[model samples]
Target chain A: MGIISKGEWIAKDIQYRIFEQPGKFDQILSSERQLSVEYEVSRNTIRNAITILENREIIQRDGKEYRLLPTKEDFETLEIMGKQSWRTQNNVVLDTSFETNKVQSQELMQPLGTNVRKVSYIRTLADSNTPIGIETAVLPTKALDDETVANLHYQSILLFVGKQFSEAFSEEYQQVNLEHADEKMAQLLKVHRGEVVVDRHSLFVSKDNSIFVELKSSILPRFSVIVQPDQDINTKVDGFVE
Target chain B: MNNEFKAPLYIQIESLIENKIVGQEYLPGERLPGERELASTYGVNRMTVKRAINNLVSRGFLIRKQGSGTYVKSHGVGDKYYFDLAFTNEQSNAGISELLAKNGIKVSNQILGREMIVRSHFLAKKLGLSADDEIFGLHRVRNIDNEPFAVEYNYLPGSLFANAMEIDFQTIGLYDYMNSKGAQPRHVYQRIQTLRAMEKEATLLQVDKGDWLYLIQYQSADQEGRLVEYTESFLNPEKVNLKFTVVKPSI
Candidate 1:
């Protein structure tokens, strides 16, 4: 994978337009005359690049005109598992409870012998009082100041923690599964006892290699979970164990 | 009337029919039982059955042919919902075709064309190459069990894969060829999104207009961080389910 030549680069640029913004250009630089003028490349270079793109099926020669190929839709729905900020969507919080306790080894990658703040709450749909989900969030107490922790009543704790720490943190790990609701969970979710539910667990890690928060959510069967990984980061986990 | 039931009779009837359609009890373009027959089967009035049928028709599940009976609408290929939770590590190195083959699924490729080209500005920046550098481009359509599922476009550095243009991609997997060339990809970056089929895509994929597709852009590099290949693949969403796991590094 050494350095590529200029013609290949231009060829890729044209291909990107077809995929990222299809049909924007009726036909990519319809003629060799337009290609040389727009791309500021020699005739030979433009011809080579266009041939490359043609070979890739990014563009096709329709008679005399070269038309860009149609691809899939461009719009994207992104859902970052753990790093997403908690916001109410047509749902009202029924109750909230906060407590402070020693950090458990299971909760953090390595217990720092420090206390953590735990926030738990239940939410229901606005139209009907039917429960939707329950969330439990745990954050290191030492990482935040007293003011930030006090204001965590009904706001997004991830945002609050982000503002407190200078280093950036992102969702590092997430696991989603279907599980039967226990008696207490069923009571909160208003579902039949032992009904199937969506359970998700996530861990957010800071840039400096600290697991700052752990979140667990149990959602009713009516809801669907969408997880979109961050594209910019190299999120490939080696030896991925389910 | 049973007051304990949460849903009304008409709504429950609608769901029953819808489930049958989804479960393939009634196939696409298959005519459904008459409204009177449905009413007697459900012990409901003709109006209730009519309403249930109307609901499905409006939702695109059923269609009423003029002067004929109601029929399940043909949703084209890949209508059945099947999801695959694909692990990136396994997919990136092994290639999707090989992965599917291992699962007892037949994978085939139709090579559209191959040619040598000079780098464009975007490709130059992406592959860390000079604008004038030569590269090889390959276009192909990938199918499973003889059904077209994905269209693939691949770009490889000519300096490393000068003989790429000579290989017959229709019979040989691209990754296998790369591995043979001692350029097996070690790292990969990918972006996945849901997209609607454009006209050309719809025709190539044999899907109707506006069918949902899974678009995956993949870039891979060797151990030394030299860009090996970049690919854009459009997949039929209905036939595939993608799943990946992310883990935090130990401190």
Candidate 2:
């Protein structure tokens, strides 16, 4: 959660690589030339990263080659994980608004006539200001505390809830499909009507399966849903019986 | 599977329709015959037919309109899954063929081409090989029930898998082949994204040009921590559903 420089991020990536490919990756750490080629970084950057690693005792200077040592498991999430981890990415929200109403009919995992809050926003790149995605989030009104409900403006609902309830949060069951751009979506996304867009629907549920949040996103073709099936879940389900 | 005695006629009729749906005899969104017609077809009474239809509707296999009767519910091509080909027999990384066969669906693959070539600069950087090293490229299209849904290309180090030029890819999975050579793909890094299909891809996947495709790119490392393979697979989204269940790592 701390802001890290590029060299620090690369250092964390090197540590993760060593853990992932435990016995073999240490050989790459033997020399600066090998480390630079292995990570596709400049020799100077690799030098900076190696100094950080050595100071942390992740690796030690031996007679000819570096020796691997024990260190705490601390790594950058986005650098180690290829393709953006949707939940962890720093999304800049733009043109956000909120509306509250009572549910008229039965909702997914919600009973009829529950009070709910809805927010619609466009996500933009901080540097480019180009619209990348549009998202709509809906949640029960009671899920929020008074401070969050009172000061609601343009903010990320996921980040808000994630900061508050980090322990119980488990994200990411996603369904990706294609949808034609509607008039409102076309104007917001700057795409012609009827053009194809990637539609993603996701759910963030609690580990105890109590709280649930539904997120629906419409993104340009530049974005795609990444799925790395958890081996633990695969074993638990035993090949998805349903 | 406890069948001590004969169940009721309606329940048996319910399972009969269920099997037909699962077996793909009655396709998704295809209407079932009317109750009167079905009762006569099965030599049953109208009430019995009505009960069977009612059971299927509640079980989510069939939908009933006011006047149109019942139709098979479409669960997006109904289990014609283009699943992960990264398989190991011991770990149960089940491939497409095993999964489809488990569901009683037929699976087949057509080998497009399998050739050996010298490594390029890109391959050398990724696989950590010297220039002029040999690499194997295998191309195939995966079909379920004779309908093509996925097109794939797998690249492997020929120095490690010299028999790649001779092994029949249709008979064994790419990961299984690697395991047979004493190398196990124990760690993998994959990226999933969407792309618009171009002319060649559109034709191969049977989708119109500009249609969206699910592009999956993977690099796998063997048990010895040597990067062994890189695969690129394009799947027609309409024909297959990619469902993901992700567990969040604690920060």
Candidate 3:
């Protein structure tokens, strides 16, 4: 590949510096103006340098200046996607919270309703410490009562349910759509009043008894989600004997 | 051009300059042509160019000073995108074709392929089709920006369209053609997901294997509630952006 542009290199440096300082982005970037003046360079070069940092989410623009935010959940997601490439990994992040309450059932859709209540803990990707996507779970009421569920570090609810109940998942139904981040979610996402986020809502059903598991992945448009084709054929091989 | 089709002359001039700046034709901090020169180039009145420059000044794309002429803004940044409801006007079959043409992507009939397959067990379950019924399978590749972005596989009952195969697939959108043939859709059930692009997918899309791909499947129905269209598209996540709105059902 071609050499990294000077503008891009400067941007990465700013991003590292901002992430390290956290909330001191404006101070660091504004200081670069002095350096530009000394080097006899136009302020445009400094601006280009800062633009790179903003795009990386290491710093965010706040009116005429920029700010730094740090997020733990967002870091972990990037760590996984970073395996793809440095550029692909630097997508935008939104942080937010969501609540699902049980209501009357409808013809087309319904909320999770089970006597053995289950509450899934999920996290979404974040940039500069903002929530972009989240994952929540629903289990029988009894599942939430587990001590492990109460105090755990990022519990994989699917794995927990599968091992405990011998429940093998059969097929998953996913609904991908877009929606405006709600006020509460928008605040958590750290976005403007009505920014758009991609919504990936999925329903996983158990093969044995047809139990359904729902998952939602809300994200900024920058990142892409990939899934392999589902090839689960529920047939008995022994029955094919001629 | 019609008055409605043409933007205000000043607005047009303003946008033209903005596009040049954003397109990097005029780099940041580059000096724009003088007012007299620009007026002669665009064949617009000088006052129109001045108004356009003033608008650009307020829009943060240009800077003006007492002695110096107009200069492109150096700090032009932050292209904010907010998600909202899908706008029908933003969507057009012809626009897609035009973009593809501009990108030099070509489409061929590819042997006029067709297949009669069993109703998808999945679709039969979603659309209430009979388990044993057969549906027409029509598959095609849509090119975008000089590369294939999607491989569409559509399944519909043969009875739905009398000459589904005979319809023009190149010049018109399949959905629009269906509507014009009296199969106007009222609502559709859509399922979207992301999947790893496999070898077959990679070859078809001209993308590397294991690239990220988005899959969208839809079952559309008419006003009378008859199932009319079932389409599944595997697309490049980079080429197209999906936008829609979801609202809570009123109690």
Candidate 4:
């Protein structure tokens, strides 16, 4: 690309801000005024830049405030793949060998509503020969009724539920956090009390609205999240040793 | 607004200034408000403002001299990140060189090999060159703290980057100079994978042969959507980590 023209540069900056800070337009300068000032350029230049963002569905001008347009499900899927790749690159691991004391039915709050069922296989992921994540996945008996689903291993849960039984798994949601591992979790992961670790609770669902599986991956806190707008990523793989 | 993660303060400050430029609050060629004034306005120390402005200067965002006041520099073709790091170094104690510095990484460049060969059918299509046309192959190793972290091999159509042989392998960022010469990167695509390091890579990264590594191959294109640069980054499994944020529908 040639040198960025004053107008184009201004536009790119606005687009980046809108993506980075979802709803700061009111407190910050509008893309329009910003373009006029910096480039000694026209408001239309800013509008054109914003138009491109609108086309991508990153943001929508709502009354006076520009609201962020939520990304489609593919973003989360790609994001997980990236994180898993990074952790593998870093060689951090989670030990998933902790045995379960009991397998019982329990009720938990879910987005769709309250659901009750037996959850199984509390697992952990490890890196550098140390555990970094602990996961206790709950599955509704109805969802796991088939013998095939029941016999599946931890690694094949998403695949069996997604590709084989239900519709193709294409959507995911995740909450990332940095905090100390709780006592129980700390014991399972074998980390010191109050040590910071990366926590990512992710859920994958099918187009038919079935909850395929949930994965909770943890890592050492030195990692970060880098979000780039307008990129498409497919497939998911998790590992510690690259 | 800076994303409220515990990112370094200097990065936050730099982004703030970048925002002002984007907002047109600081127009091109226009002098920024005085350091004291900006410090007071931003509620930061004057030294902080100095650092920020110095970074802008190195980034081609601002121009300065010993006696004369600072002014915005016009965008010129050159390594943008190189100048960016130069300016960033002026402000914060660590500077933009933080990426490599924090990891205690040092780079040693060796032109492993170079050759002129005909472009393959696949490569020819990507570079807009004839399938049988000649291109230069440049291979180099990047070391971190005396250990190799990545080996890069590049293919360039000889017609482009003709003075390619003159590149000071030990110094200078390729893209920065290309940008100055009017080569800018407008888009990039990348694919990442996890694999075991081979004997050659194991020797370079100083790890066992069976150890793992992250492989990233990326292609960058110009504004006209023409392919310009292709790169491969092989990361040592022990030293580096990657981060990516995924967004999707709420369902």
Which of the predicted structures, 1 or 2, would earn the higher TM-score when compared with the native? 2
Per-residue lDDT of model 4, residues B151-208, tens digit only = 6655666666667667775565555545554545444444444445655556766788
Better of 2 and 4 by TM-score: 2
* TM-score of chain A, model number 1: 0.49
Q: What lDDT score belongs to each candidate, Candidate 1 first?
A: 0.62, 0.63, 0.51, 0.48
| Candidate 1: stretches off by over 4 Å | A1-242, B1-92, B249-251
Query: Tens digits of per-residue lDDT for model 2 on B6-99?
Result: 8888998898788777754465655688899999989999899899989999999998766546777778535434343333222554445665
Which is better, 1 or 4, measured by TM-score? Answer: 1
lDDT of 1 by residue, A110-148 (tens): 444546666666655445566667767677656655565
Ten contiguous residues with the weakest lDDT in model 3 chain A:
A233-242
Worst 10 residues of 2 chain A by lDDT: A71-80
Tell me the spans in candidate 2 whose CA falls farther than 4 Å from its real position.
A1-116, A126-129, A145-155, A223-242, B1-54, B57-72, B75-91, B128-133, B182-186, B222-226, B248-251
Better candidate by lDDT, 2 or 3: 2
Give the higher-lDDT candidate: 1 or 3. 1
- TM-score leader: 2
TM agreement with the true structure for every prediction: 0.46, 0.59, 0.38, 0.38
Winner on DockQ between 2 and 4 is: 2
Candidate 2, residues A83-148, lDDT tens digits: the string is 222322223343233443222222334444655566666665545666666877776666765466
Poorest stretch of ten by lDDT in candidate 4 chain A: A233-242
Q: Evaluate chain B of model 4: give its TM-score.
A: 0.55
- How do the candidates rank by lDDT, highest first? 2, 1, 3, 4
lDDT of 1: 0.62
